[model samples]
Target: MGERYLKSVRLLAECLQGFERFVAEPVRRHGLTHPQFDIIATLGNTPGMTYKELGERTLITKGTLTGVIDRLEQKGLVERARNCDDKRSFLVRLTAEGDTLFRNVFPAVVAHGKQLFADYGDGDFEQLDHALRRLRTRLDTPGLVTPGGHVPADEG
Candidate 1:
């Protein structure tokens, strides 16, 4: 059982690495890193999330989030405004340019994700999606125990 578990872990790691590489190619062509894209996508949906919220939503560290936000702000893809409730914190929102870029690129992103799992039939996709959702819910549940006895925020 231990050997089997180890093999499964190794396989999952390889799969994740491969998926990252595959997605990285297109994101690079769009002139954005994975973290940059994540921030933009989040801002697109949420509109006004503070840096701390972005870090939580993207599962990025505070240090890394600052760099990502700085780069995007430099590119005019996002803006930092003072949060009304907390003057000390800045809320992030996508610029008009950022919205345009997202609109143009998101369709391709969706297609690329679909193509990645295209080998799986509809039934397989449904089953995999269901299993992944269950796993995600369990992992996200507060105080829920993992094999390591701690449920991490970035379970990925």
Candidate 2:
């Protein structure tokens, strides 16, 4: 049973499906992709971050982030300016419109996110978070490499 559960790709796929469906309507209503919203939200917290830093924080690759930035720029949602401190890098900042939109939509987005886990009480959520954090730390440690924590593996 344990082996069957571990090998079941359906479980992971369904989890991803649930997450995608949960956010699909709201993201579409806001005229944003999930990644776009994630970038904007990260920028809202850390203003004037370079594209590299933004990519790191958003977990978006450079190539993908460039496209997102281009779209946001065309939409007048984000502005890319020369980084005064680092001439080699471009600083990404939210425009006034972007700021206003984020401010308006963030609360609703947060509420909707909360609704995703509404079935879990605070205690359960806390415990889940703690366990996940531990798992992350273990998997992410630089020096302690294990097969499971190494390069992506195909369980299929």
Candidate 3:
């Protein structure tokens, strides 16, 4: 049981790294880092979002999100403005150039992802998706995940 659990954990971690590598290639080719691309992609085609919204949607940590947003701002791809609703937080929106870049890159990256998932058809990933979602839920749920990072026996 221990061996199997260890192997599954390693495989999942490696698969995540591999998937990031696969997606990062085209993003890098477009002269943007993964985080920058992520910011642009999330902020695209919207009026704007607050730092809190962006953090939630991007799943990037506060420290990393701030730096990534700073870099994107420096590149003139994103701009910040005072959030009219809240004085403490700023709203992040793409510039015209950023919108153009997002329009161009979003589809291309998605197409690249589709190519990678070409072998998967309808109904192929439903169970896997459910399993992953379950795992994420377990991880996020306090007291549901054990000290050793395993889900509760009842869940298992």
Candidate 4:
């Protein structure tokens, strides 16, 4: 049973790594790193979001996020403005140039990535999504005991 779960974990890691490598080339062609593209895609079609919100929405950690935002700001792709509702926080949004880039590059990159799933049917997608969500929910649940009948150290 443990071996089965371990195999799944290995496969999941491999899948994530492959997906990253597959999408990375298109992102690089746009002159952006994976994290930068993630931020741009997250902020695209949206008004703006605070740093906290961005951190929550993105895979980037708060520490790395500041640096990524700084680089984007330097490239004139994004700007930070004082949040009207919260004077202590700043709202980050794409510049006009950034929006244009997002409009052009986003769909192209998405299309390129979608090619990976070209053969996947709707049912395949549904099954995959359901399985992943179920795994995530189980992982997030508290007080889950291990095979040894004790809560994992992190869970405890």
TM-score of each: 0.79, 0.79, 0.83, 0.87
Q: Per-residue lDDT of 96-130 in model 4, one digit per residue for the tens?
A: 99999899889988898899899999999999999
Model 4: C-alpha RMSD to truth?
A: 2.8
Question: Which candidate model has the greater TM-score, 2 or 3?
Answer: 3
Worst 10 residues of 1 by lDDT: 145-154
lDDT digits (tens) for residues 1-156 of candidate 1: 667657756877898898878777767888999889888777775667888888888999998888888999899999989888888999889999998878766666767877878689989979878966886797667865668766665477
Q: Give the top-scoring candidate (TM-score).
A: 4
Which parts of model 4 have CA positions greater than 4 angstroms off? 144-156
Task: Give the distance in Å from residue 44's predicted Cα in candidate 2 to where it truly belongs.
Answer: 1.1
lDDT tens digits, residue span 64-133, model 2: 9999999998999899999888799999999999888788777777787777787999899798779668
Write the residue-wise lDDT of candidate 3 on 1-156 in tens digits: 667678878989898798888888788988898778988988888999998899998888888889999989998999999987779999999999999999989898888887767887767788669878988897777656667777677464
Instruction: Provide the RMSD of all predictions against the true structure, rounded to 1 decimal.
Output: 4.3, 4.5, 4.5, 2.8
Please list the residue runs of candidate 3 whose C-alpha ends up more than 4 Å from where it truly belongs after superposition. 144-156
Top of the candidates by lDDT: 4
Query: Could you give me the TM-score of model 4 versus the true structure?
Result: 0.87
lDDT of each: 0.82, 0.82, 0.86, 0.90
Name the better of 3 and 4 by TM-score: 4
How many steric overlaps does candidate 1 have? Answer: 0
In angstroms, the error of model 2 at 82 is 1.5
What's the residue-level lDDT of 44 in candidate 1? 77
